[model samples]
Target: MCLIFRIILTAWLISSSSLSMALSIDSLRGVEKRKPNVIIIMSDDQGWGDLSMNGNPNLQTPHIDRIAKNGARFSHFYVSPVCSPTRAELLTGRYHPRAGVYSTSEGGERINLDETTMADVFKEAGYATAAFGKWHNGMQYPYHPNARGFDEFYGFCSGHWGNYFNSLLEHNGQIVQGNGFIIDDLTDKALEFIDNNQNDPFFLYLPYNTPHSPMQVPDKEWASFKDKSLIKLADARTGEEDVVFTRAALALCENIDWNVGRIQNQLKKLKLDRETIVIYLSDNGPNSSRWNGGMKGKKGSTDEGGVKSPFVIQWPGTISSGLEIDQVSGAVDLLPTLADLSGINYSIPKALDGISLKPLLVESNQKWPDRMLFSHWNGKVSVRKGRYVLDDNSKLFDLTTDPEQRVDITSQKPELTKALSMAVVDWKAEVLKDIAIDNRPFPVGHPDYKYTQLPARDAVAHGTIKRSNKYPNSSYFTNWTKNGDYISWNVDVLSEGDYAVAVYYVCPADEIGSTMQLSFEADKLDFKIAKANASGMINQQYDRVERMESYEKDFKPLKAGVIHLKKGAGELILRTTALSKTNALDFRMMMLTRESP
Candidate 1:
């Protein structure tokens, strides 16, 4: 009996010791072997010279500089000259032209539905993915961020926003008012997302819409730059640099730096700093030319300043500190690089234009192949191979000798020039082969989406109605004085359902009784304006400089009853009937909530 009891005790002791040893090994593995979280912060229209680290003495950006200081910096990073094209390239590991993104606004900005996004790959790998801030991709479902594999999305889906201070924004598919300054509001959402997903592998894309235009900055950030004298001026070639505009842009940049610091602090607080990878870059060049490291051209050009962007990546305990990579890279490389770093197995739907930069990022003395990157916008194409660039005018410049691209070297190196020119022709025929007008109608009533917002930016004004601004991104329809004045949107409703319709407009007390009809093909909902909402112009106090876009007003929502939309393509028109006053309310947006299918 004693021997049997000893045998049972001995077996119990052995099992306990094995369990304790296994837990110790798992605890060590949890700290060292877990997948790293990724946070990519992209700024809109911020130049390479916008940071102090980039030799811009006018402003200081220590927080942003720290990312470069701690990890790797790309010396020759490139992107598109515009917003949407660059965004599309970053999302997909392909040229923007291949993704059907030819323009910044309207339907052209929408990426091809079949192309897979970086968020989609991460999300499919069980990572919590979210994007906060400007999403110029598309606004409708399937094309929307939610359908593009971001579990959460909070931002405006426009080329540019009218107001930046506490303006109307969207969360997923529902319209929600922003909390504070647009940049801060986006950062707040991003911090919260990080906090919630700290335990899990997460991919957070914080695309900050700032320093773009309608140049708005917070009071604290503005106070330092408003009265200060500027040493750095724009290129003397234009000789028309607005100092106030430059100051406003610098102020906005400083505000972005502060927000970047906030993100770093959050990561440290959550003890996820070492286990997280942070990448920072800009979508395009500076909107206005202002001291961009002697690089020619600004936002709209294919010159060095227009496409050259600062790319900084930080991953403590992984990537080496203060490493400088001189190899030329572009936005297209982001998807493949990130997927490789995370060690996630993802198969792209199509052949990727970009190769994984893992060897350059992680290994020492890695041999890289010479590659040519092409930049195209508005029918202009520029090819960059090695240190030479063939400009849009079919002129080649050796960048090693002339960084400003002032001299044409095509005659000097005829063979290289001829080869590059023919390559451009082949690229255009292949990549830009299908690049044409995107006549696809604005989609609505997506079966999976509940709320659909048809803003005036997407509307076409007919008769006497006109857009408030030439740039249709954030403009409103005005001059609807006559009964015949109407606005229409080419729409494709995906579901047969009754949608609770509402019009966002500003009507004076005198124009309160104006009758309006909202129609989609044969189905129409007619309603009379009962209440008057004369909300004043917003962003006046917030605007640091005169804006090119229209000053936004509080477009109050007025319920216009319900409308039944059939599943098909047609024009959704809004026409006034009994115009009681001179104008039938300044049109802004039409909101439709799916009620019944």
Candidate 2:
């Protein structure tokens, strides 16, 4: 069946199911009002305890807290253990693994094209859709936000950016420079989008990347927590908390709160506050072992702390203010909940993994079903069902009495333990069947998109050339000391065309003379690095705390002419034919702009 017909069928079927909520609309003299606008603001690496409202005394997040005070707060909410999966879940209303999101960077981060996103649903329902800030789901066309039902997208597509201030970013499919700090710049663009679409129903997704490392926050924000004393630290049992890093993270969260306030102010200024639904949430747990309400595990673990997130929603004159829901929700529920609450009919193209939270929010006395929610990452799976948790190792714990998973109650609840264990095995067998191995190649030169970007994060370095850091996102290929050293990417050109290639790189004044060649199949293009661009790292100068990811440099893009490539799959390789000094250049990215047909 066609996509449109399938969605129509699903909508019809789902409307009759118990998951559907009554369409909410205001009528004046029998004239129907416009649909409610949606603005979902998500933070990166900000944990449940990062907010002052969440009982953290280190920093303040009044703007984020206001969402809870004005509307509803979910006390027990869950998300993926990492960024990309949570993003996939939010977009599709399905489990991340079902959508082929197994990793945070490169090809694995791309959601399968077959999966329909919430943007698709909203756009199809005649709502204007745009996404601002970090788009970790995918970077290329088709998988890119532009093809994923978002009319406009402005941000970096990588998992995490290296620099946050006046850094390189993208608008739609074109590369551009950001205005100031990334979070602020993204908010500015979102405000512009809202201004343009004030009269229309719109879905705005502002996914902020912050507090996630490179530890860069504005000086104003950094000043507040630079030397502030902390009363709460990461659990003493873990013993891995760094005070400086914690301070930096708290400062970043405060900055995010400021941006959140800006967004709220914009809506209020436009008089759309009561007409729009605003939500605030974090993608995962804390990036570091900071104070997180004494919950176990950090970002990568599938425990309560790692997967738990603070979920706050504000819909003035609609959702009751200060309504604290003790029900367990997850990132997967956002799409359906928003669609149902807004009266927009959309059906999951595949089997839906999330149910609408409309009953819990709108119908307080409704008989909410007791369902199990699963959190999986890096081969660890944990199931949460009504205050009880079955951890990855088949150990059970009642969260009401043991929130830290300290005492395994398997002996006390043998039957429940066995049933949950078998459920995990069945769930794994079903969700992980297709993703056991990834043989897909990165795509290039789609007919619909004019430009294709292949950054160092997606490339493989050969010989003595090594990546600047262990984390691939926003990293560069350096130490290119040998002639045979090269960087390559497995790519499939979707269209045959002549593409104008540009290489973003940096070379010292002494090591400026090197001939670099890029080849795919039998086609080749050569460029000489005759000029020097000695741009040093920028992170150390701006970072309030030490960073683990590679610092970014202002690499100049060298236009290396054009090469005609046929439609096919092959290794796109970059190597030096002749080196002048000890190194060739610090390679950052390659851009391919397809010439007009």
Candidate 3:
């Protein structure tokens, strides 16, 4: 076994007592059939009530619903309120904060390298592992899917993408051109992986980056939902009247369902449906203004609607048809659960905020006790225990009686509130013990990522963030807004090597003489660029599009000289000392390329 796998297994064996009853390694070795192929399909922003099976009146996700109908459904499933945290929790089998992820951008999205992932366990057990679609965990090496454990990876690394049609994507470690709508293309690629690896046990994690934002869809998919009055019930519940946003949002959801249907059909055609364990769930709740099964808050909030998600586990023989498991669970449970199901003796070494749900899935009579489940975003914190929920605001809700959280019951349940509050406090403390993990550097000289592009989202801006486009994914730095302003990327020099740096920015005609200095350690390189038109430079050079609207941004470039020395970690900063005009520059990316050792 590999050293890491041995460490994970040895650590797990020492910690777990009841895993033998769940499924031991010796028992898995003696099984008659080859280990079942695992396919995990996770949508980006789907919610509990976004499906017809879960009582969403607006849309019917028949393909997604079939997985729930034929297998086990988690009625009280929970996850982090945002994309990156839930993914970190799912992959590491620990709390997001504990696993070195607390936010979507600015270096907070990277997963820690030491934590063993579900795919890592499966890969050690001889499964052909792959990850498709959205990889929001991290962009650079050691955290990328290929380095994390997957043998194959094809996806984008950002929290959300700008385009859906014919986008440039990463295949393994190389950039490749995509052919169809991103969702359809991802499904096709996943199907192809299955076709090639059918002889061996395979684990495919398909986290689609669609139905989240940009509101772009094929003409046919949008046509299906635009004219129909689909959201009267949803509107009454959400109290949203923007018809255009509603139509576009519904269109994205239905299109995702269509892609799901395509994958299900492929499995059936390949005759692999019976021998595979398929899971369908979402990273978090809905991003748009829509119905969320009457839960309290939307995405990014520490409430039921933000954290609740639909979880379905479908296996032909073992899991019964239409079984609803009401045990409270979090995304952290997924890693240990999948490892247990696969019969791999691997466990995470740190805080195991999530436990294995193997017994609960196998036996309906298994009594899994309820524990405190904490949700966090910025300064908000929420604790959920069975039907009761307590937030950072000191508001309490008995969800069994007050599902909408309309009334606060702190006065009635003083003792219970205090206990839950204390649990949340303790959990947060344990998770945040290593607060430096959130701002740790992504390695610069790794082979998987020879050139590191530090976008505006990942860089630290000393001034207030002002974007040409106010969308969350837009790139910019209005340097003139503040005196002595600068931006930098937190990065480690993974290896000593020769390098080149490319800076992406914008400068008006009058600001042609603006000078930028790229500094790291004791070395510095200066640059001065021309007054060329900055119109649509991002799309021209890198094919980046406006995330939400028609606005297209451009950037000027500078060839900053590079040097080599001892290997270590530090910040890569770009500072401007002089500008002919008020604003020195607006930046999109700063790329560092290693030439040689």
Q: Pick the candidate with the highest TM-score.
A: 1
TM-score of each: 0.95, 0.94, 0.83
lDDT of each: 0.90, 0.90, 0.75
With a 3 Å backbone cut-off (N, CA, C), the pairs that clash in candidate 2 are: none
Count clashing pairs, candidate 3. 2
- Writing each residue's lDDT as its tens digit, candidate 2 over 422-477 gives 98999999998887688878889999999899999999999999999999999999
Q: What is the C-alpha RMSD of each candidate to the true structure, in Å?
A: 2.6, 9.3, 10.0
Evaluated at residue 473, the lDDT of candidate 3 is 47
Model 3, span 1-597: residue lDDT tens: 699999999889866756675567658676566788899989888767778887766776898899988889988888888899999888888777777786676667888778878888889888999999888887777777888889988887777776577765768655567777889899999989999988888999999986777677678776677677755344354456455665666677788888888878888998988888899888887776676666777777778888888899998888888888866888888887877777777645666778888898787567777677788877578888888889778789988787677889999999998998888788778767675545467677785556665667677677653555554344466645444567777778787777787676666666667677777788677776555445443233222222353233545456766756347888877777565567777776666677886
Which residues of candidate 2, in runs, are more than 4 Å off? Answer: 1-30
Candidate 3 stretches with Cα past 4 Å from truth are 1-32, 234-241, 407-415, 433-439, 447-451, 461-474, 477-487, 500-566, 574-587
Better of 2 and 3 by lDDT: 2
